[model samples]
Target: MPRADFPTPVKNLIAELKRLPGVGPRSAERMAVWLLQNKKAEPTALAEALVLAEEKIISCPACGFFATAEVCEICTDPKRDETLLCVVEQATDVLPLERSGAFKGRYHCLGGKLSPLDRVSPEDLLIPQLISRIEAISGEMEIILALGADVEGEATSNYLADLMRGKPVKITRIAQGLPAGGGLEHADELTLIRALQGRRDF
Candidate 1:
């Protein structure tokens, strides 16, 4: 006879959990068991929160950051510097920079980097929106490329820099050789601060 495993419902929960990033089969099984068996684990509350987030959270059209309102808090903040625009790979990248407290400027998330292998092109990202935002700015602005030091990030940065070559904006990239092969999410506050302070012209 075949050995019995988790019930169908429990197995289904584990399978769903496995779909989450960085979660393997064993981790998902453990999480599923904990959620079903642990008294402290409020599965209903968790489900409700997830549903609420999915229903309410939307990407800011202006800067591509997560927001409940039409515009994100950063874009509407009067204290942030309008003259500086930090370009990043994704919405998740914005928080690390914010936590560093080094950049008081606005942000533009590209959504993803250019990768030939991944078939992600400039058109696949928010490049057109980025151009529109740059054109909308009146005075001289500095665009800081805060992308990773990975190959795809480098390609994306170069592409953006070349595209904005004749524009009035000054282009710079965060100091590399530090965050090599890593995204901003992996960086600590001090490292991010140093990178921002040590930015160089692209």
Candidate 2:
């Protein structure tokens, strides 16, 4: 039998690294070796940061974005246009939109998209919370669906539009500058700008 290139600790590190999205076996192994070769404090610092984040950080009660407090900073900001609400899938999607500087509105994270094949339904998302938010505002609010451009996203958008048909709020969807099947994180600033500017009624 061939000798193992890694010891038990290194093998365990590689396994944990591989659990991260988009990291393959080779990449995880390389990361494990690099972490070990570097100063021991580097890995220790990384571990400490992860542990602290997991311990202190939590989903915002109002918007579903990450927050150390009850509500996220964006949701609590009075300057943000309360009449405009942007809806996205994951909490990470909020970062890309904020980075684009194209929107000055608050947000509602859906937790995930509706995919019947994946067995994710409307009830599985934070849709009830979203409805409560709209009802609480109940004053000329507009909902912008900033979701992925995949089939699932389209279906979800259509479903949401139908659901909001009787509501007083205006519903719109982000425009087509985003590439097909791509999420908000994949879009550049200019793309996001155009999409936001060219949004149409749903």
Candidate 3:
């Protein structure tokens, strides 16, 4: 049986939660206590959910988005434009754009931005896959860089634009409607739609 004040597993759970970004030790402890007091069933459900997610979720092969299969539903869909590609930094960023109803094209997840200081290089991202996808899709395709408006995002966008030069395709960037340091995951649908509408040349 576990003690009321501090069980061993409970202490371990609190410590693990504290390791998460933005969660402090006090907060983790409070959460653990709360779970013990009133959320026993909920915590078991949460644990099951996490385990299911870990087992089932995978990176989509085509767009690198989180999905249950190799290729995401969006990539396999025949309705979306095959030529146009909207490049984003992560799969979570795809929701706001999709909810905005402005983008008719498909998406490309870079996985992350270029941060040489953090050892994130061009190869770290899916740049080569992007290039190959562009090559595979013929005709006058457009590549929309929808990365965040930050130093790292700017550097990554510039790098991609330079790489796509002389490829006979148009490369444009998303509009600067989003504030500096803002993330696409937090942006509302209206702002995202306007940003896509007002996108200019790279």
Instruction: Output the number of the lDDT-best candidate.
Output: 1
* Native-to-model Cα distance after best TM-score fit, residue 75 in candidate 1, in Å: 0.8
Please give the lDDT score at residue 156 for candidate 2.
81
lDDT scores in order: 0.93, 0.90, 0.90
TM-score of 3: 0.84
lDDT over C-alpha atoms for residue 136 of model 3: 92
**Candidate 2 regions off by >4 Å?**
178-202
Error of 3 at 157 (Å): 0.4
Off by over 4 Å in 1: 177-202
Candidate achieving higher lDDT, 1 or 3: 1
Off by over 4 Å in 3: 1-5, 39-41, 178-202
How high a TM-score does candidate 1 get?
A: 0.87
Q: Whose TM-score is greatest here?
A: 1
Sliding window of 10 residues with minimal summed lDDT for model 1 = 173-182
Please report the TM-score between candidate 2 and the true structure. 0.85
The residue pairs found clashing in candidate 1 are: none
